[model samples]
Target: MKKGLLLIYLVLCQVYVYAQEDAWVYLTDKDNTGFSISNPPQFLTQQAIDRKNSQGIAIDNRDLPVNETYISQLKNQAGITVMAKSKWFNAVHVRGIQEDIDALATLEFVDYIDFANSSLNRSASNSNRQDKFEIEESLIDFEYGGTQNQVEMINLDNLHLSDYTGNEIIIAVLDAGFPNVNTMSSFQRLRNNNDLLGGYDFVDRTDNVYEFAGSNHGTKVLSVMAGFVQDQYVGTAPDASYYLFRTEDVGSENPVEESYWVEAAERADSLGVHIINSSLGYTVYDNPNYSYTPSQMNGQVAFISKGATIASEKGILVVNSAGNSGNNSWQIVGAPADASKVFSIGGVDASGAYSSFSSQGSATQSTLKPDVVARASSTFVIDQFDVIVNNNGTSFSSPIMAGAMACLKQALPSVSNEQLKQFTRMSASQYTTPDFMMGYGIPDMQMALNLALSVQEETFGELKIFPNPVKNELHIQLPSDTDTTLMIYDVLGKLVLKKSFNSTYQKINTSSMISGMYILRIESSSGSKTFKLIKS
Candidate 1:
């Protein structure tokens, strides 16, 4: 009887020794590549190349795909199963026993192995994994119906009236399952117009993104940008094209989802997507050992946040939800939202008040977080069942802001993503007095449009505008002698100051002007020039 008990105990020990753990295998190089940066068509689409060219971004080695031979070698290893691969990071996400994973480090192509369990890896850190899809109660004009308040609060309706409704722009939605979006009545217009492009389920490694059994958080998030019902409801960017990507696995909280998200982001970049809306944030995880500490909230620490910053550097306008942990002990924005380059969005109510549940910015980071706020309280969204319902969370607010950004992109195709973010911040209600909760506060889409338009008309050569964000005085210097008429208009298009000068320099008193963005236009016989002026 004692011998039999010993045998059983040995069998249990073997099982425990072989338990699978998630990890990322970093490859040393992409040595065997047939693609060249000069011939970008070999890997990048024409649209993507054009976008990079327009933004003055060069195609580099980072854009190259990972070595498939390396991936195959890792897969052939004993007990190792490759899950997701990222070309941007030159790494592959895998699952295997610790012994098996560690053996991969001996391969010639393998750079190192990062275990998902932070305790196992010395240089690696984990993310805080929260339920980003949690329902919160929370649009745009043109019979916006339940969405009128949300839309008008951000002044997106004015842009809609001006015909800047996101035409010819593409936005990718990265989230959980989007069940029923392919068959729902609320998405009928998108289907009929062929605005619903293709999508992929990275979590399931499938092409069908609308058939998953996970949470329907993606369905409602997309509705805020693409759903439409005549005379009843209209999404913020109803005319924008879309690409759905399911990167999150709602069934469990794991670091592999971050790899999946980066993989999806790479696909979006390859597909020439102009904007990416990720209504998700990571904070705490199911495994306590993989949970991130508050200090890791710095934009560069988390893997997902690093990927988000790379996506932005690639010229994609990456928008993320700030998180819904404001009322909880974890009262700070999560990964990707904390990423410096990402345009993080926060939540607010109908009265333009901060939502109690909107995540706050970290006191450690120098950059302002929750870059701007939008209506998230009792915001209306179309569920998987085609029913209009009120939901709450930054998930809804992020999409709302994303749709507005699409319209702005359509209106100012020449503006870079960084400039777009700056213009949006300058147009916010609290640009001069931003806070942790609201950041720059609610954005005025019309004002942002005006700011972009004014900057686009800068034609005067050698013209210099100084002391911008000026306190009490503004200075201007011209190239040559010419009778120039100067006029300053508020963001509302209301004339605030007018003067005519022929000298090479001019100064204007701006002490009495309210702190905000204004357009300074100068006209002469040569041509008209416009400058974006800020009074602080």
Candidate 2:
């Protein structure tokens, strides 16, 4: 009889363990009755406030912290364990049995409860979740060594020569783990200059981001931008400051990881981070019921994607990997990468070809994704063990582009994040003809800088160009009534049309031109002006 009771008890224990689940308890209001947007310093740092003010981004309720009173009340509830909280979404992630999680909805402050396991929820929504080191020939001034090809492929070398090496820019790296970043020899420069700011481990709920026992993916990713060894290996943006964040739990895949990411992003925003390089992407979860469908890659659907969009709206440039599902059956870019505001980076080979493993964009989405490609195939990085090695995946490509963008940001401090994205896309090799595999293709940083400068130095009087995506006739309005020379060039830099116009308003016949992107340059006595034209 004792043995029978023991068996029954063991069975009950197993059931209880299996019954435990994760969920998000959303609060109805923040209860910030006395908070004011004008006084942003209460919650935001001075640097963060300055960044918003410079960008003309107004401070709003989203900047307000979640109500601590509501959180404390939820903590007092039995069987409810608060895991993570997000101010942006006004939600708190918790773990408990189905009944315990559901009971939270009865509270006055509780808005609703969204379970990680969709089957357990009453709502309709479902949520979810390297190689060797070597040294090569140096071509530019910086001793890039093995990383020369990856940097030069995107033309970031030119920016380095001009001393736009991401000085004063703070970047937040959200990934799995960053082991040995403090002890690595390549990161000594960052330590000496205090560019390795600080970090937090959202997964472990601790301040030590480098002590996680998970995979060292974050460490490798950081080396692509922050690693610097004299004449051996130079990262893309060696002078940039960084805040390492561990958000991913390598042991298990769950929606709570997404909550962890949102929390880290909020922290980065409060600390005034300029760029966020997230080499992580989410689609499937350990619980199949919490898995996301490809149709949900619409950017607005996923929780993490929404947080990323908010980060972008907060004046932070969010760069994410396009994912490595290209060769798999589920061949599409993952969420957060699918977010329209994110600069989703794809991977390409050294020969300027798209990497087969780099995830592609879906055809159903109206917006073009995998915004740009970078040299991620066999990309070089510094390992946690302090060895120079080559690795593959869009994971490395995102940082390559992020570091280049930091350099561009340093060069054009006044340029907004949206304009910087546009300039980079316009500078891509395949901007005229983007596809699912290589949307806008690889960016040329030198060309991007030139485009930005051209727009900034438009000293010529206001010129109006209408019907930009012209199907037949193209209209051009000159600033002054003077003889203006108009020239149009194809993506290959070949002059296609050249004509002289005397009238203030001129109409050019473009009915016979092919459908693609063209550069229209107008030269006159006032000044020369350039415009990008699309012929539909």
Candidate 3:
């Protein structure tokens, strides 16, 4: 009797373990093309759930179970269990194994799957972005162009970095490693500011990956976000904080690299990575057969893309590069790039013309892609020695925007990631009429900031501009008592006019300016202010 009872207990324990694997916390891959926050895909089978879990290596917490009807419907599918159903949305976390991944990919309702991976601190980045204008004329960086654009750097000089920095808005940059950052002069301020949160090393499965500098990619990405510079390559948001995860190893673009990214995303979420900017893309790899076909662009085919979307739904922001495909035939968005929910950035020249290298759209039946464009060609960045290097790619664009979003999030810490994305689309150059070419168009940081502030209060400021459509002679007033500076910019973010209006009351004239939308910025001894002006 004792032997029989023991056997029964052992059998029951095995069943429980299998049951645990059968259920998982379901999350949408907001960055995945066919799946994610902005575009969600349907769950397929149990096999699909297991596959995604194997990729993510993270738990989807199966505290809840799927409804009876839903379970009955999914009975035919392999590796699938209705772990739980969301009362609000179709999104639900499920469980299964690798076979489920294949099954779900074939299902019409399935979008993508993220499996569990154990690697950590792995990140990817959009490395090449241009802060300098890309017009046909000689491009001037923020420094030299300040005079021509009429933007007074001095006006924005006093804005305290921390006042606009948010602790919760952290991004984990996955790349080779950053050994020189602590000693590098360009990144010293970031280190001193303690801008870096703790990180992990997935390659060795050890914590000692930070000791040596390996790939320049991660370092460059960090420089674009946190590198402190006044005249040199100023990151999109210099004061913003970040955490660096070393997931990529030197020299090899391993097939397992995707697994590493999954690990990084999990760690990033645990450590509260507000955003993820990975410049890497996948199509070809060490395993040629493992390479993806255009048909696999559905989002579930690639492990990393699946994980990218999973991260986004967890409230972590994810940005990916559309790929440098302008020069290639497979010019469409890559794996994770094909994932729907994530923001895939494209590259534009200093002339504002789209670059030939920027990857195209999500390939699985033409979905929205390159959600936005930023300066990527011949863009300036800090290299190994803090020297400015003009490189190009959607890789750099992602980080610059990530940094800017960080500042925006800092300005309004309460704004959910969903709302931020919505604002970005609505305030974009092509919000209402989005195209596959540019998801919404480039984002204007100033306008975005102004709008975010406006939503928070009855009025962001008591300031106003008159002669609303004045072709010239623009007028302005503010309620601040401190000394002030005035600046006017064109719709292109180029400063066309500027003056000092330190007095509490002052009249300004822009009668000589051309007709178009303009921005009037007010800068008190305190930071700065922005206004939307129209010249007709």
Per-prediction CA RMSD (Å): 4.4, 4.9, 15.6
Model 3 clash tally, residue pairs: 64
Task: State residue 25's C-alpha deviation in candidate 1, in Å.
Answer: 1.4
What is the per-residue lDDT of model 2 for residues 406-481, given as tens digits with 9 covering 90 to 100? 9999999999999899889988988879999999999999988877765532223667776755678877777678
Give per-residue CA lDDT, model 3, range 77-180, as digits (tens): 76575433332222334555545634555644544443332111121222232211121222333454321110111112212243554444567887667666
| Candidate 3 stretches greater than 4 Å from native | 1-168, 210-214, 363-367, 453-536
- The candidates, ranked best first by lDDT, are 1, 2, 3
Candidate 3 displacement at residue 454 in angstroms? 5.0
TM-score of 2: 0.87
Descending-TM-score candidate ranking:
1, 2, 3
- Candidate 3 vs. true structure, TM-score: 0.58
Q: Can you give the lDDT of residue 350 in candidate 3?
A: 67
Candidate 2 — which residues are off by over 4 angstroms?
1-18, 32-34, 124-144, 456-502, 507-536
lDDT of each: 0.86, 0.86, 0.58
TM-score of each: 0.89, 0.87, 0.58
| Residue 499 of model 2, lDDT score | 92
Q: lDDT of candidate 3 vs native? A: 0.58
